[model samples]
Every structure is written in C-alpha cells, then in structure tokens.
Target: MKRIFALFILLSAVFLTACGEDEGNAGSSGEKDTINFGATAGPYSDMVTQAIAPLLEEKGYEVTNKEFTDYVQPNKALANGDLDANLFQHKIYLDSFAEENNLELSEVIIVPTAPMGIYSNKYEDIDSVEKGSTMGVPNDPTNLARALIVLEDEGLVKINEDVDPLRASLADIEDNPKSLDFVEVEAGQLPRLVDSEDLAAVPGNYALAAKMDLLDALALEDMPDDYRNRVVVNTEDIDAPYVKDIKEVIESDEFEEIIDEEFQGFGKPKWMEEE
Candidate 1:
C-alpha cells in the first residue's frame, strides 16, 4: 500500500506539471493581440485586407477585417467596442451619420475618395445637356447633398448660400437656368437610371461596379484642397495604439500603389500627398 501511494503521488505531480505548461502556452497564444477592424465590402475593404493588413502583421498587429454592407452598423459596432476601427466613409458622411444616429465617432485618418461623377449616355459633355432635360440624383440626404455640390461646381445649378450641405435639396436650388427635372433615386440605383434619364450623378464605387469608365462621365467631382475624404474610429479610441497603426498602414506606400493600380488612377491617394 505504501508503494502504491508513492506511485500515485508521482503520477499526479507529473500530470499537474504538464497541465500547467499547456495552460501557460494557451495564455500566451490566446491573449488579445489582434486588432479587429470593420469596412464596407468593396475594392476599398479588399485593399485593406490585401495590402493594409499584411503591412500591419509585419509590425506585430494581427488584423482581422470584418466586412459590412451598410454604413451605419460599422460605426455603431466601433462605438460599442465590437471593432477597433472602420475605413468606409468620408468625414462629411461620417459627421452626418453620427448626427442622425446620435453616435459619438471621430475621424482618425483620411482614406481615398471615390470621386462622384455625372454620367450620361445621351450627352458627351455637361454643356450638351439641354434645357428641361431630366437629371437623376441620389435620394439619400448625404449623397443628395454631395450630388448637388458636384452640380453646383460644374455650373449646372446654384445651391443656396445659407443652406448647409447636409440639408441642401432641390428647394435650395436658387438658380436653374436649364430647368432640368431632378429625379431622386436610390444612390445604388443611380448608375442604372443613366440608361433612362438624360444624365445621372453616380458615386465612383457604384460607377465602377456598373462597369462605367471615369473618362466616359460628363464630369467628376473636383479633388480640391477642401475635399473631405476620411476613415473614422470611435471617439473613445481615436488615440488607441491599434487605431494609430491602422492609420499608418493606410497612409503607407503599399496602400497608395494598390489604389493607383486597381482604381486605374480613378482613386488617388489624397491622404499622403496633395493632388
């Protein structure tokens, strides 16, 4: 009986030692070392996964990019601590989204802007647009305002000076010499409307998806010094380390190269150098 008890104690000690080592190894590997990111599904998000994430991994951050379809959920997830960062919206859109949803998110970095363009199968140039011609614009407030701004810039229409970009509408059009009929449609459907309407203002991503070339467009949004293209993070995490690393990766040359190549010069890197 003494010998059996001694043998049992020895086996127990060996088993405990092995279990302790295994637990230590798991603790080291299972610790939270990955930066969880979110982005809308598109070339932009794919670029983040392909170019940006690899660069971050070299710097010791494990990047897990979560893809989202709609705009609001990504910000909400970031604000609620479900994500470390998101790279799918500009400052103007982000500000408007936060205001309408009552969320407190902040801009951490400026990404590329998919320049909004006016496309027309009927006309080759903005000047060719006839009076009383129908024009399609996005119905969403954010994109509607953006489309209006593009029109105003092209001298097609004049927006009211007192109206904010967030709230501008057809009513704000103080001058419309062309008397163009404005047809408001869903932003995603704007490109399709080009076939029916005389002209339509479509966002760059949608235009690309619809296989429309930028050169084919009547006009594109100007990339001026005041252009507001950006990525956003939760206000509480604006200064976080992982978020900073994300900004650096996005601003890196690798990301710039991807933008220039994949977008065929349509998407320029505005964050790094002045255009």
Candidate 2:
C-alpha cells in the first residue's frame, strides 16, 4: 500500500510539472495578449509596426503585423482568420470584397490615406495640358470613379451630378472641356503612363507601389472623408473592446504625429493636413 501510494504521488507530480511547462512555454511565446494585424507591403505595414503597434502596447495590447505584397491576400487572410484585422484598403474595396466573396468584414474606422493625384509628366500642370490630350485612368470601379472625381474637380471633365461617386463611369461624364481622350488602364499601370498621358490619376497605394512621389503630383482631388482608407475586422469582432481601443488609438494625437513624421502625403490624416 505504501509503495502504491508513492507511485501515485510520483505520477501526479510528473503530470503537474508537464502542465506547468506547457503554461511557461505559452507565456514564452509572447502572444498571449498579442493581436495579429495585416497590411500591404508599403507605408501601411510600416505604420502598423512603427506607430499603431506602439500605441496598442500603451493600452495593454500587443500587435504583430503581417505584411502582404499585393491587394488580394490581406483581405483573404482577415476573412479566414489568418489575421485579427487588416488596415490596407478603403471602404469601397472592402464593401465590394465582402459582397463578392460573401465574407462578413466590418470597417473599424476610416484612416486617412493620401489622395488620388492627377499626375502629368507630359504637361507641367493642369493649365498647360492642351485640349484633346490623352488621359490615363484606372479601369477598376472604385479607383476609376476616384480618378474621375479628381478630373472633374480640376475642371478637366464633368460627371453627372446625380451619379454615386463610387459608381461613376465614363458614361456618367456630362462634359469634357478639353475633349480629353481617356485611356482606361489598370490602376497599377497608370503611374507607368505618366510620360505618355497628359494626366494620369493614380491612387496613392499604386503610386507607392510604382515608386512615384505623391507630393510631386500636379493636382490632387478634394478628397472626401469617405475615400479615406479603413481599418477592418471580422464582423463578429465589430463590437470587441480591443477593436474599439484600436479605433481610439487611431484617432489619438500620438498616431497623428507618427503619420505626419513617417508617411508624407501617403496615408495622410486630415488632422495632419490641418496641422
């Protein structure tokens, strides 16, 4: 009986020791309070780690960022739980992605990315461009409409006032003062066409991807607040405390300082612009 009792004690001690080691290992991994974040490869990812993550740490949250090279994967990773949240795209892209994929993602907050600039390598400025000059624009819906908005704002073209800005197409153009010939190209291709087209409207993300300077562009649109980039999360997490905390941090002055210091015209905040 004594020997049996001793053996039972030994087994119990071993089991407890094993369990303790597992707990210790988990703590050592340093992911207990960490949030997995996703962003695209340029300034967005840099801002996440350099700016946002530090703020999250101050609020007792740890952030680990995953950077994606292209547009498709960040959304895919977030939808399937590979990422806790993603901060790379605007509302238009997120909404269209959700509808098309039947994935339920929700926007946490609108983050200010840089405006889509109407760039011209051929002409020195909008005024110098002659009538009937070729224009390069994005063919993708959201960016295409975004480009049109800039063009119209610059008085190079006009869109039907009734059309939704997100859905506006060439067919919606009410007038073309320059009789401007628009050549539809992929969003990524517009920057490459700077020397060829009279004006090419390029989103800041694509501009970054193409290694172009946003501040050097000739004309920028009066960017609407809705056109701002968004930080998004799974629909189930829309009301989560951490998500709310994330939004608060984004809106804070600390984050704004970081944005002004790091991102230049790309991913610029409205508050930063005011300053």
Candidate 3:
C-alpha cells in the first residue's frame, strides 16, 4: 500500500510538470511581439539594424529586419500586411509609388534624406565640364526631373516652367548651351556609366555602393525641407504600440548619433515636432 501511494504521487507530479511545459510552449508558438522592418541593402539599412534595432530590443520588442533590392516591394509588403513597417523611400517616392500601385500606405516618420549628387570620372570640376559632353541621368521619371532641376539650378540647362517634376523628360529642356548630350539610363545603370560618360547624376545609395567618395562629387542637391525622406506604414498600423515605439527609437538621440557618426554629413534625420 505504501509503495503504491508513492508511485501514484510521483505520477501526479510528472503529469503536472508536463502540463506546465506544454502551456509555456503554446504561449510562445505564434509570431513574436516583434516589429518587422523592411529596408534596402545599403548603409541605410545597416545603420538602422545596428543602431536602432538593439534599442528597440532593449525595450522588450523583437526586431525583424527585411532586406529588399528593388524600390517597390517594401511598400507593397507593408500595404499587404506582410511587414509591420518600412524604412526606405522618401515622401515623394512613397506617394508616387502608392498612387501607381493603388496602395493606401502613409508616412509614419521622416528619417533622413540622402542628398543626390552628380559624379564624373572625366571632369575634375563642374566648371571644367565642356559643352556637348555626354551626361548620364536616371531614366526614372522622378529622378530624371530632379536631375534636370539640379542642372537648371546650376544654369547648365533650362526646363519649361510647366513641366511636372514627377514627369519631366529630355524633351522638356528648353535650353542646352553646351549642346550637352543627355543620356537616360536606368538608375542602377547610371553608376556604371560614370566610366564612360562625362557626367552622371547618381543617387547617394548607388554612389556609396560604387565605392565613390560622396564628397568628390561636383554637385549635391539641397535636400533641406524636402519631403523626400520618410518611413512609412499602413494606416491601420500607424497607431500600433510597436509602430509608436519604432518612431520614438528613430527620433531618439541614439539614432541621430549613429547617423552623424556613420554617415559623416551624408545622412541626417528630419523628424516632425508637435507644435
């Protein structure tokens, strides 16, 4: 009788322990309480994962970093609920992308703008650039307009006042004093053209990827007060706790320090403040 009682007690204890273990495992089975962030594979994404992710993790939120190569998929993932948010793209690009794709994504925060620059292997300086030299610019509509605007600002070319910044093309150029040859190439291919073309207006990311010194570029666009840098999320998730946490972490002093230290004047955050 004593042996039977002892065996029954042991069996009861073992069953209780098993039940507890199962409950704990079940509680942790589904998606973690994580903020899924999407970014392109570049300094921008690296900096965020290194400087920003750890901070959020310290606050008890898991961080998942998703890398994208193209411009469209990140926003699409956010809109489709595959991602919690995205860190790439500026407001201009985001708005245009949404309009084109029929997405209803919204900007949750403005992070930083990578000042666009024009790089060349042939000319030592912008003044040394001769008239009629071939110039390679991004073929994308928005960037094409931006490149033309920069040229216009430098008195290198003149564009019609009626030309839309998002749709401007070579046909919109009203004047080209040097008979400059404007070559339209895909954005990714523009960096490769630097070896052949007299000048190329390259995005900052591409310039960095090509290992070119950003400071060596002959000209950089003034991106201050430009609505071209932002992080976006679906409208439904804008008010989520994790999304709010991400916004705070991005706007924190830590993130700013990382940007200043890593980018060395190339990237800077521009967060909106409450009045």
Candidate 4:
C-alpha cells in the first residue's frame, strides 16, 4: 500500500509539471522566448514569415506562425491563449469582436492594409458611372459601412448625418445623386461580380485573394486608420517583453523597407504616413 501511494504522488507531480510547461508556451503566461503568432492565410501570413519572424529570430526568440482560414478562429485562438499575437483584423473589428465575445484583446500597432475599392467592368472611371446603375457591396455590417463611406467619399451617395458611419447600411443612404441601385452580396463573392455588376465594392483582402490589383479600381477607399489591420494581443499581455520586441521590429526602419519592397499598394496608417 505504501509503495502504490508513492507512485501515485510521483505521477501527479509529473502531470502538473507538464501542464505548467504547456501554459508557459501559450504566451499570456509571461513566456518571453517562444512566441506564437496567428494570421490569415495569404499576405498577412506572408508578412509574418517574410518580415517579422526573421527580425524576432535574430533577437533570439523562436517564432511560430499559425495560419487561420477564417476570420472567427484567429480571435478565438488568441482569446483562449493559443496565439501570442495575431495580425489580420482592423481596430473597428478588434473592438467589436472583443465586446461581443467578452474577450480582452488589444492592438499593439496598425500595419499597412489593403484598402477596399470600387471596381467596375461597365465603367472605366467614377465619372462614367451612369444613373440608376446597380452596385455590389459587402453584406457584413462593418464592411458594408466602409463601402458606403467610400461611395460617399466619391460623391456617389450620402449617409444620414445621425447614423454611426461604422454601422451604416443601405437604409442609411439619405441621398443617391446617381439614383444608384445597391445590392448586398457576400464579401467573398463581390470580386467575381465585378464582371457582372455595374460596380462592386471589394474589400482589399478579398480583392487580393481574387488576384485583382488594387490599382485596377475606379476609386480606392481613403481609409481611416481604424480600418487598417493591426497586431493584436490579449489585454493582459499588452506589455509583455515579447510584445515589446514585436512592436520594435514592426517600427524598425528595416520593417518599412520590407513593406515598401513586398507590400506595394497597401494603404499606410497615419503613423506610417506621418513618418
């Protein structure tokens, strides 16, 4: 009986030690050496692999990149301590997702993000858009607001003065000078509709995924800094040692050189533009 009891205690100690090691690797546990990052598959993931990871590796950290295929999982992973940081969503999205899900995520820095634009096969330029023409926009709330604001910027439509621009919808349009007919389409499908619709408002990420050039748009969005993608971390780890390292690398001159060389056509944040 004494021997069996001693073995059970030994096994419990081993199990607890293993659990602690796993927690340390999760990043929020204050681990400073091995850091994990999450991003959507494509440009943002490429950004981590080609630009950020090398710099962090040079600083003696082991960096791992996890590519998520959907918008939902990255934040879910980040919130549950699966990722040290993530770089796929903008400030507005970060704020909304955190509030809705009761997650404590925060941004470390905004990165150059692809801007949504008005793409049309029927019209060569914004001026050429005829009256009563139909246009495609994202069905999602945030991006729909963004597309409407872009249309307003181009003098195509006007949103109601009292509505929050981030939550604007087709019903919020106070005036449509062109008498434009609007169609709400799933964001991923908007790119394909460019050949069919009079004009389609394609978000920058989807446009790139569809192999459309940012320069091909009739008018690109004059995006506010809130719409730009950012590096996100758990609120608790905002001031972690590894988080500081990641921020310094992004703000480095070497980082700008990489973005300029590899990420042309992405919209710059105000801080980046000011520099």
| Candidate lDDT values, in order | 0.79, 0.83, 0.77, 0.92
Indicate which candidate wins on TM-score.
Answer: 4
lDDT of 4 by residue, 10-53 (tens): 99999998787677554445467888999999889999999999
Cα lDDT for residue 196, model 1?
99
- Report the error of model 1 at residue 88, Å: 1.9
Compose the digit string of candidate 1's lDDT tens values, residues 245-267: 87887777787787677665354
User: How does residue 56 of candidate 3 score in lDDT?
Assistant: 90
Flag regions of model 1 displaced more than 4 Å: 1-32, 96-104, 223-229, 265-271
Q: Give per-residue CA lDDT, model 2, range 1-275, as digits (tens).
A: 99999999999999987786566223444333567899988878887898889999997776899989877899899988888899888776788889998999999877768778988877878889898899899998878888888888788888999998778999999999899998998888888888787778888877877888888888876777667878899999888777888898988899888877887775455654665
Worst 10 residues of 1 by lDDT: 24-33
How much is the lDDT of residue 207 in candidate 3?
82
Clashing pairs in 2: 113-267, 114-267
74: Cα error in model 3, Å: 2.3
Q: After the best TM-score superposition of candidate 3, give how far the Cα of residue 112 lies from its true spot, in angstroms.
A: 1.3
TM-score of each: 0.78, 0.84, 0.79, 0.85
Q: Candidate 2 vs candidate 3: which has greater lDDT?
A: 2
Positional deviation of 178 in candidate 1, in angstroms? Answer: 2.4
Q: Kindly give the stretch of ten consecutive residues in candidate 2 with the minimal lDDT sum.
A: 24-33
